[model samples]
Target: MRLALLSPLPPDPSRLAHHAAQFRRALNLGGIDVLTPLVGQRPLESLEAARAWVAERDWRGVDVVHAELAPGQRTVYWVLQALARLPHGPALTATVHAPPGLLGQPLHAPFAGVYHARWLPRLTRQASAWLAAPFTRHIDRRLARRLAGVLCTSDASATRLARRLGLPRERITVLPQGLPELACPPLPSGPLKLLCLSGPGQALRPLQDLVAALGQLVAQGGDDLPPWQLTLAGATAASCFEPPRHDPLTRLQADPRLKALGDRIAWQLDPDPQDLPALMAAHHLLVLPERPQPWGLGEAEPGPTAPQGACDLALAVGRPLLVAQQSGQAEQVTSGNGATYTVGDHATLLAVLQDLLTDPDRLSDWATQARRQATSRQWTQMSARYVGFFQQAVARSTRAATK
Candidate 1:
């Protein structure tokens, strides 16, 4: 079948773009005729072009128009709606990558929230007011009714969308994000080096906690402990670091414990994607300490759902990971493969690190288990599942239209 896969395409690092690329490849492999818009140099320009491009395509040959929608993009939503309303239009299916409910949940802790809160009030107020407003709500209702199917990223997300949109659970499907294939290398001998990969202005507080834990461990006469190092990549922007101008590498640079082991601990400002997997494979443990944010107002309580990309990647590499207990993806981690600790629990983190460093046999066991788990969760397999969901939606939409 000819499928016009409507999405913002790559070399953009946005998650949607990545997913679209993956989807395109999978559809082609499945022998589906796909038409993707040419994404230009700038995003807005490319989106406009894409809309116009899709409008001109022959709908008769297109069995379906699969659009991936991100929340809060009113223009794109309107464009897609217009396309779906076209006379003799193809079937419409939307994959909602980030919905209002998912977006409302804070992905990171204090510092990230502090930055978000600066601009979030106006945005949230506008969005909430718009949803409540009669005309806007009416329009949204019409759009929801017209949509053939909606796809959510997680079961939790699907449930949230069903309640918020008042749509039946049957109308929504859950499709989780997948990781790229990575080879699991044998565990390196000697010190168990730890690595952390994060984007600009992402969570750095967790790294600070790790540094503090390392210092505390050394102070407690754990100097004889096997060497451990941390390599940080992907925080170039100044806003990335928290105040005090002291990063983990900088703080421990001159210290005897880290200095004596020179080059053991290092930070790369930025690394290319191709090099990342190999870099990740070289490490013994991947550490991601994502702190959860409090939800709602007036005696707000900590809500679940911490970021999970790091943990996911670590698992994909088949490496033992140390993630914060509060992270959204912590459920995927297990003692058989890796372990989780409470946020800022330096004592626990230190003990875990020490144990891995001191006990070589246990470290080997963890590494093996981690690799086994990672193999089961490859992106290719995940993509095939997504394709299955898409096929089901297409069939359902066609049946509904015929009736």
Candidate 2:
């Protein structure tokens, strides 16, 4: 059977795009023909063109027209929705790759009409975000319904999508994000090398708080303790230091906290996304110290969902996690795998670090378990599962059509 995938290739560096590419390769390797039109950077333009592309050939001959829905993938969603309404339309499915926090409790509902008016879009984006949210959801429900299963990357996400989008919980499949085939590096021999991955925007305040907590640890270090190094990536390096201690707002080239900690803090300036897996493997732990949840009350987003990419890489590379309790990223974590600390709680972070550093045995144990988790969710296995899910989706769709 043939599947036509509506998703992006590489160089875009989105989590959804990365997984789409992974599934394509795995399915092809497993003997399924995956066809994708040559859609480049301008996806909306390409999506509009796909109508003609399909009309010229056999769009109906395709078994499944699968699309992954991201903010960037909206145009493709519209196109697929339009296509599903045609006579003898092909079966279509979608993978909801958006984080649950954004989907579950949308801040966009407040900004409903603001999205369309170009000038208004710049003002109250809440209206626009609300307006843009349910693009073809109603149609998607009727067309694909049970047959066109909505794929979610996590169980928590699937649950949220069901509750928020009002879709059937049974119809949503939990297909976690896939990682590139990567080998878990050996455990650290020296100080704990902690890598802090910053979120999409200037979400570094929590990291700064953790650093300050570490500073407090250093100050209280009249007692001997194991040392740790923090390497941050994603956003520009900034200090969350207090006014008297350091500049509060500006990003200093050389943070004094680094000096206070004997220069242990470092950051990556927009590292290439392709290099991330290797970077994740290099570090011993991946920490996403995201802010608290229920975002959009005149503060940084609470990061309602887990830091999926960060958590995925850490698990894939066998590096244990040190995530915030507020993030959904901490969902599957256990005392055996890694630790979760409260956001901005430097003392908790300090205590967790002190315990891990002192007890290397526990640290090593967590890493081992992390690798096992990674092995279970390997791309090869995930792709096989996707193929199964697709077949099921097609049969359901075919049966529904017959009825």
Candidate 3:
């Protein structure tokens, strides 16, 4: 069926852009005609001009206009707002990525989830966001009601959307990230190659825990513990403005405990996003150190959720996961796939890692399980389900109109 997909064009640095790119790829695989609305010959210079153009568009021909949502993304916000005004427009649908917009923008507390703008001073923006947050949330609630369906990468995000928009659980669908089916590669020899893709935000730091765990492992077992490798990508602080950035790697590297375990854990500084799949495949398991419910200044905000890209990558590459128990990725890490631990608790993560790192057999089992999870959620399979959701929404709307 014909559809108009509203999302940032790819290479824009938001993981959601990459997600939209992947979804577009999946839609193509399913043989669906997709359209992306872009600038015209007149060259719209500002967001206002862009909104005006969108306001005047005739979109009735398409069956669905699938938009992507991240907390406080102005472009997506405007586009969705424009669509919202049209009662006769294509059926509305969206995929909401949990908090931390692609461009590394911080979303404030749940009720007031807005990003820090470069143009606006910090104090002024905070004041404006506080005032506008409720209004934006109101719009979001209305948008949810207008949508035929809402998609979230994790069930946690779905629940958050339901709460924020006051939509029924059924109105939001958990379409966890999907990857193409691939044969499970043979388990690699030697130490478990642990990988993490945590770009340093004060909010999460699995590497520190990894280092702590490493120290414990060495302290208890000396070299007797199972030999394992560690590779962390994007452990650097993402940004320091909204919330201060934390650099766990630099700290861990300095610790006498971590220095003792030299060269055991390798650090990948800003690895190319394009190489992520190959990277995942090369590793044994992916680690997520985020809390399930994100916090702001020690107080929890129930607004937007955290990112679950590691879950999708793990699924895609058949790598087991070591995710935080509270993080949304926890849902993807079943008993067989990986272990989960409370994010801030160092001992639990230490013990869990010790078990798998020491025993090759368990690691192999989890790898097999990871591949199974990936196999079950392949894009070829999921894309069909995704398309069907849109079709079903359109069909239902059409039926309601006839009645």
Say which candidate scores most in TM-score.
3
- Please provide, for model 3 over 231-324, each residue's C-alpha lDDT reduced to its tens digit, 9 standing for 90 to 100: 8665344433343345555555576766677788677765665677777788887777765433332222221112355567667778888887
lDDT of all the models against the reference? Answer: 0.62, 0.65, 0.66
| Winning model by lDDT | 3
Q: What's the true lDDT of residue 387 in model 2? A: 88
What is the Å distance of residue 248 in model 3 from its true position? 2.8
Cα lDDT tens digits for candidate 1, 154-234: 666677777766778888877556666777878876677888665532455665666677777766745577677778665
TM-score-better candidate, 1 vs 3? 3
Please estimate how well model 1 matches the true structure, expressed as its whole-model Cα lDDT: 0.62
TM-score of each: 0.70, 0.78, 0.80
Give lDDT: candidate 2, residue 340. 87
> How high is the lDDT of residue 108 in model 1?
24
The regions of model 2 sitting more than 4 angstroms off are: 10-16, 38-57, 99-121, 131-147, 219-221, 237-259, 270-275, 291-306, 332-336, 345-347
Those runs of model 1 whose alpha carbons end farther than 4 Å from true positions after fitting are: 10-15, 37-57, 71-76, 86-89, 101-145, 219-221, 238-265, 291-309, 334-336, 347-351, 358-362
lDDT of 2 by residue, 333-372 (tens): 7636888888777778888887876888888888888888
Candidate 3 clashing pairs, residues 3+ apart or interchain:
14-102, 99-305, 110-303, 191-227, 292-326, 292-327
* TM-score of model 2 vs. true structure: 0.78
Model 1's TM-score against the true structure: 0.70
